[model samples]
Target: MAHDPITAVVPAFNESETIASVVAYLIRAPEVNEVIVVDNNSVDNTASVASTAGARVVTETRQGMGHAFKAGVAAAQNDWVMKVDADLERFGPRLVSCLANARAPGIGLVKGAWQDPGDDMPMTRLLVQPAVAALCPALAELTAPNSGIYLMDRSRIAHTELRGNYAVDLDAMLRMAWAGHGVAEVDIGQIENDRRSPAHYSAMAHEIMGFFLDCARASSKASST
Candidate 1:
């Protein structure tokens, strides 16, 4: 199968401090053809910085990460899309490149897997992993289903029901698997990110748990029929 060029999308919110390097990495990556930054109601100079760093900038009025990503992907000029967080400090070869290289002919979604330097992904280890094992056993091997960095083909999402919340990552993976799209994962290496307050993690855990429980209930109902 022939390879398709990828559109890199960065969903940002007041990430002026790190957005430049993020966009620069994507632009410099061999697999990326275009870089787009969706500024999600940022009060900072994220948009200007991204543009200066050689990225096309767009704005999303919505407040959630899922909304920002949807807006960026909607504006993507390429069928293959790569999206990542703007706040992370990446030091190795671009994770986008790694994900793109992992792509196979039948694979529609390529998820980025990385070791967190600070073990910040408690939600993934504790909650999301078990939910995935129960819901989609095929994806139970994924170590970072909640990772913000991933590459996906937009053409495969026509009938996939995507969530607009923090569980969006898991939602996409599960939906794509349910849609019969091949899912692949690649190790993107170690990534460093600032630690957030416990309160932030609290909210994230609540949202993720709620989404998985709802999915469990739905699955039970479907099986009972």
Candidate 2:
């Protein structure tokens, strides 16, 4: 089946070492119409390298994934938007599957979980998943609650407030489910990336937990009203 052209939105920060390869891989996908790289004020040559690799570059002076993504999506010209991390280039077949899942009926959001060859931070399994299960049970079904890659129908995620950093993925899931849309998770294969520092990981955990707590409070307030 033929699917609508897709715009792949990549949020990059100091990824000059691998941004070019990542953009090249995304651009090669037959389903992708354009690869928009939102350079998040990288001190490195990330923007120039990505542009050299054939991606249309946009500047998001903001230094957060959520900010970069918001800029990228807004710049996207297609109806379908796929969020990809600039450092993970193992997209090959996974890109095709994401596009297919996005085209599936009644599915407003498609999230990619790392499978064989893909590795995730301990925080994902230990914190993000369990917190969602406790506060937002509906979203606990996601195998990879912290996955960075997702294909969303533009309208479905419009105006959604994303968390600033690593918490973006978990926050996105919670928001999507809160908005009453179906979210599907798929194994997109391996993603090669270095682990973050323990301090950074802990910070991400704090944000994930905060998102859950905030959502719980919002739900409670809505119910009481």
Candidate 3:
């Protein structure tokens, strides 16, 4: 079956140093019909560089990845949308193919797993991932619940609720599973980017933990119904 046109939504903040290369790589994908860069109030020239590199730039006033994504998804013109990080220097061409393969009939969401590039995976993230897996069968239904790279059918967006912070990916996955939508993962090869410093990783872990806590409470309430 012929696939629908794809729109890649790249959410960036202070990514001036690498935004162009990321945009360039996505444009090379034959399946990508358009690229939209959503800048989340970056202090640098992320928007200017992205524009110069031939991407349509949209600015999101809210300062989180989820906010940037909401703006980008609202602006997307394609039937399908792929969320990609702006820091990647060389997103493999096959990455697009992997995502497409997961879109087989009945699949509503496809997530991409990262092959860590020699960076130590944070103990906190490692702890949270499996904990989420064990506690939330709705989200654990997916092979990789926290993957940032996701290809979603536009129609599914209406049913998925996105939290306003870092846990949006996990939140979306749980909702997709609860809706009885098919969710799967595609093994995208190694992302050769620098890892976040320990401090940044700590901050991410805190944010993820908060999100999961909220999810657990919400899920518990729903189960009582």
RMSD of candidates 1 onward, in order: 1.6, 2.2, 2.1
Q: On a 0 to 100 scale, what is the lDDT of residue 98 in model 3?
A: 84
Best by lDDT: 1
TM-score of 3: 0.90
Ten contiguous residues with the weakest lDDT in model 2? 89-98
For each candidate, the alpha-carbon lDDT, in order, equals 0.84, 0.77, 0.79
Off by over 4 Å in 3: 123-125, 138-143
For this target, which candidate reaches the highest TM-score against the unseen true structure? 1
Predicted candidate 3, C-alpha RMSD? 2.1
Clashes of each: 0, 0, 0
In angstroms, the error of model 2 at 91 is 5.5
Candidate 2: the clashing residue pairs are none
Q: Which run of 10 residues does model 3 get worst, by summed lDDT?
A: 119-128
lDDT of 1 by residue, 1-225 (tens): 126889988889999999998888888887788999999999989999999999999898978777888888888889888878899885567576688888887888999988767876777888888889989999899888887788888888752346667887778778878889899998988887788988988988888898899898999999999
lDDT for each residue of candidate 3 in 1-225, tens digit (9 for 90 to 100): 137788899999999999998898788888888999999999999999999998999999988888888788889998688889888875566887788667877778889976766754554257656867766555554446677898887676562357766777766666666677778788887777676677976777788888877777887998899
Candidates 1 and 2, the one with greater lDDT: 1
